[model samples]
Target: MAAVSLSVSTVKPLGDRIFIKVSEAEAKTAGGILLPDNAQEKPQVGEVTAVGPGKRSDDGTRQELDVKVGDKVLYSKYAGTEVKLAGEEYILLSEKDILAVVA
Candidate 1:
């Protein structure tokens, strides 16, 4: 798929998908030790910035998604394809890839 080029104010997810503003990957340890770039873990948590109209069901009706914009969620470590928009980082993934919503 072509990469989306959108400003956060205008972007909306297209299908049972969501746009996430990825949290910055941690750069230091709890002990205050600085970590190199390559040592930082790929962040799996992010805040939902936009959500799609839910996926179509077998009967062709759309089911509502469990999450909404602003929900903090944890997804599979490698779930979404990363994209940069208006100088900010984001990931696009299906709702199924989100493992949990951080309450």
Candidate 2:
């Protein structure tokens, strides 16, 4: 799907999902040589730009998400749907897919 240019107000993740702004892969290694496009690893960490209204519990009450907007998170690689909006990349994934929140 074509990504919509992101703004916290423009996109709201549904259910237990979240919107994450993926960090760019490093263009160069520690040695300073630029890595080719094929050599860069997929980034698993990102800043949460937006979040859903929270998931429903078995009792039908809303359960809060562990991560909030502006929280840095580590997610499973190849877990979420990828979208590019106005040349910027973002991911939409369920909260369960998030591995951890970075301190």
Candidate 3:
């Protein structure tokens, strides 16, 4: 198989799928104690990078997603597929997995 190249600009989610760039995990706690990498929890917050047009309704109408690109969002824990692109962490998840859009 031929090698394929992938980038943020080259990715386009389809049918309510969303692409997000994961935020860095907190390195220190509120008490000012440093935590090890293994002790850090997976971050559920991220910035929207790419989004699908919309989901298809039963009547064949497209239902637009509430979130858009550049929106900081909180998603369900254990949701989405983790992706590594260009040494950066990302997540590909369905719209349903997103809990809320951070203000």
TM-score of 1: 0.89
Candidate achieving the largest TM-score: 3
RMSD of each: 2.8, 3.0, 0.6
Model 3 TM: 0.98
Q: lDDT by residue for model 1 over 1-103, one digit each (tens)?
A: 9975568878778779999999999999999999999999989999999999999999999999899999999999888889888787899999999999998
Displacement of the residue 5 alpha carbon in candidate 1, Å: 6.0
Write down the lDDT of every candidate, Cα atoms only: 0.91, 0.90, 0.98
Per-candidate count of clashing residue pairs (backbone under 3 Å): 0, 0, 0
Indicate whether candidate 1 or candidate 3 has the larger TM-score: 3
| Per-model TM values vs. the true structure | 0.89, 0.87, 0.98
Candidate 3 residue pairs that clash: none
Sort the candidates on TM-score, descending order. Answer: 3, 1, 2
Q: Can you write out model 3's per-residue Cα lDDT over 12-100, one digit (the tens) per residue?
A: 99999999999999999999999999999999999999999999999999999999999999999999999999999999999999999
Worst 10 residues of 3 by lDDT: 76-85
Cα lDDT of candidate 2 equals 0.90
